[model samples]
Target: MAKKQHYKHNNGAMYLMLSPYLLLLFFFGILPAIMGVLEIPKPSMANANGGWDAFKIVIHDFRFGPALRHVLGFMGIFVPLMIFFVIGMALMLDIKHSPWKKWLRMAYIVPASISGAVAVLVWYVILQPTLSPIKGVLRYFHITESSQIWQQQNLVYILAIMAFFAAAGNWILIQYGSLQSISTEVLEAARVDGASVWQTAIRIKLPLISKYIVYMSVLVFAGGLQIFVEPQLLNGGIYQGIADSWSFDQLSYNLAFMQGDFGGASALSILLLIPSLLGALLVIFKTDMFEGAQGHIKKKDVEIVGI
Candidate 1:
């Protein structure tokens, strides 16, 4: 009873401390989400379902279709590949006696830190045939012009690579940290059962950290869906309308600022947000991730008692 009370008191104090940030989140994040629902464009007198008609307009628009395809394709590539590499690298990195571990961790982080405009510039230089170190490879593929490389169809691969480098490093370290939490006792028992190194990692280590991976996947999907800066900077920076409205976010930006269609922008935003919200709920329920989170809170409570 005393421990429960102390735990409640500590949590209450923490929440109290966090109130300001929570308030700001409500004002900025939650408030806009709520407002977006109401701000969906209202249709004309001819259309009976005004909001639905407006939403349909945004959906059926020519630009919306291409942007939709681009985002879906981008997510398809980025999500699976990112998960595979992050997990594989993290598992390899967890090797007990690896001397390169410390330096390798730094190596992952450094590239990840070079993000946003810098990443765009870095990738641009690398892709630019005259400037690239891989100019020989480009020429061998018979690529001579920027147009050959920067085609609309190839943006999927281009953006995926940029997004991967921008994010995969941090996720590798995060997955590595999750790998560290696997109990040594369980691992020893696996060894006693004659499990090889790869076998132990597959059968023992992965399941323990699976929830974190699911959580990471959910967030990555959400982030990829909201992709803007990469395509935006590419189009706006140098290419000038080459990738204009290449993503949902870019389309939404055009609706709001360029076209002055706030309602359409809000409608588009709501549409994009739906999948993210559903993905989060799916993770929480389908994986029982919320239940696992409760255990973490209990673990913290036990730690407080030890203190």
Candidate 2:
């Protein structure tokens, strides 16, 4: 009877400690989710002329498909490109023979500390038509001053570059840390087996850090879907279409404020919420992210390439 009372007392204390967190989760997470579901138009209201008709109207909009396509294309380009760079840089920095690993790592991560908006503006100045550092090269190529890269067909490339500057450093930091976490014995075994640096990195180190790669991919995909700041800040009113329906988030914003379609904006927002939520769930349940930092690839689990 005394032990049972003691257990009840401990349980009460635990609940008391968890109360604040539970309250915050309810207010910020659960409450907002409930509100979002309420905002989505039901089938009856979706067929109406105005209130919840946003679901029907937005789906039929000409710009809807293009907006999704642009974001998907950007994700397709950005995730793979960033992954390659991140892994390459991480491998370079993680090299046991490197003399300047610390300084190089610092240099690589510095861009991540810069604000996204500021990074976009800095790229804007460099890519601007007349003020660009490469203006002379433009003239050498016989390109007229009336046209610029930002305003030309190469706008997609320019957009990708700006997004890279804003996001690449953070990913490098993640990849580099993952590489560092790898046990030295595994790397030594690979080296003993006559594996070159590239082979060891590609085969052993990459597999060990596979979970990080998966997490980063999901994160980059979700982030890519929500892209608005880079295109909006980079264009700076020089081009109109870059932000009008360039991304779904921007499209939802335009619907809400520019067109006074609150219901439609809410509907679009709810639709976007699905992917982000799914990605979060994947990281939480599918990956070992929350498994107390044990990491996915153990030293014993890796197969030597040359042996």
How well does candidate 2 match the true structure, expressed as C-alpha RMSD?
Answer: 6.4
In model 2, the runs with Cα more than 4 Å from the true position are 1-6, 42-54, 133-146, 234-242, 293-307
Under the 3 Å rule for N, CA and C atoms, how many clashes does model 1 have?
0
Residue-wise C-alpha lDDT for candidate 2, range 1-307, written one tens digit per residue:
9999999999999999999999999999899877766665633333355555666678887879987777777777787888888778778777675666667767767777655677666666676557767878767876555444556346556666767767788788788888888898998899999999889988999999988988988887788778887766645455655456777877887776877666677788888988887787667656786678447544343232211
Best by lDDT: 1
Candidate 1's TM-score: 0.84
Query: Each model's C-alpha lDDT?
Result: 0.86, 0.74
Encode model 1's per-residue lDDT on 1-307: one tens digit a residue.
Answer: 9999999999999999999999999999899898888777454332335665668788877899899889889999999999999999999898774767789898998888877899899988888888988889989998878778888789999999999999999999999998888888998899999999999889899999998889999999999999998899999997887789999999999888987777788888998888898787667555756774765555455355442
Candidates in order, TM-scores: namely 0.84, 0.82
